[model samples]
Target: MTIKPIIIIPDPLLRQVSKPVERVDSDLTHLIDDMLDTMYDAPGIGLAAVQVAVPRRLLVIDVSKEGEDKQPLVFINPEIIRSSEDRSVYEEGCLSIPDYYAEVERPATVTVKHLDRLGKEQLTEADGLLATCLQHEIDHLNGVLFIDHISRLKREMVIKKFSKAAKSKVTV
Candidate 1:
């Protein structure tokens, strides 16, 4: 599987809402494989298709700790069906945002409905890091970023920083 280039902040594509996956074919399967490869290569727990400039409602995640067996998960057209009122905070990072991280509060548990790798419908009840990762990636599908959960001042500062870096790369 190929490791795709991850699009960073200030890239308009990263803000684009992803389209739902209509079917699971060989091409879709290949994309899933590539996404998993890309996520692992990024050394990140989760990744969304939009982060790779693919406007598809797909995401890959592996929240396993180092040295443990990798447990990769694929979610297509994922939607949060239910979420606990209980809240939790995690220092969240995104591949698209690179090194930036922020404490984001979200539901402690979530029930997500999505299509499995085989296109079969599945509902996953997730908690802890898994729940946070799922929520983060699913937010990407809707053109939302983890920074959006932070204060507006901090979010703007991050966007400005990345925007300047992106400009330098273009001029260089």
Candidate 2:
């Protein structure tokens, strides 16, 4: 598997809705492998296909704690089937929006349906960090960012910061 370069914020592609994968073939499996590699390399808990400029409904996540064996998860064409009425807040960060973090509130529990890397249909019930990470990555698939959940002032500020950094050719 190869580590793909993650597309940063201010890239218009990040705002585009990802297309669904029609078939789960070797090529798609290979892409999943690359995504996992990229996510691990970024040392992030979750990553979406759009983040790597693939523009497909795919994501990889590993919410395992540091020093624990990594538990990698792959989601293709994932759909949130259920979400609890209860809410939880977490300080979330995204690889696309590097070095910036904000507290976002979402459902405390969620159940998602998706195709596994092996092409089998799967449903996952997640809570805590896993639930938050899943929701965040899925947002990328829908052309939404965590900042969208924050206040408009903060969102604009973040976009401005990233836009300026991009224009100045400075790493964010």
Write model 2 residue lDDT over 5-100, tens digit each, in one string. 999989999999999999999999899889899999988999999999999999999998999998999999999999999999999999999999
**Number of the top-ranking candidate, with TM-score as the measure:** 1
RMSD of 1: 0.9
Superposed on all Cα atoms, the candidates' RMSDs to the truth, in angstroms, are 0.9, 2.1
For model 1, residues 52-100, the per-residue Cα lDDT tens digits are 8899999999999999999999999999999999999999998899899
Model 1 lDDT on a 0 to 1 scale: 0.94
Runs in model 2 with CA error above 4 Å?
Answer: 170-172
Whose lDDT is greatest here?
Answer: 2
Candidate 2 residue-wise lDDT at 136: 98
Which residue pairs show collisions in model 2?
none
- Ten contiguous residues with the weakest lDDT in model 2: 163-172
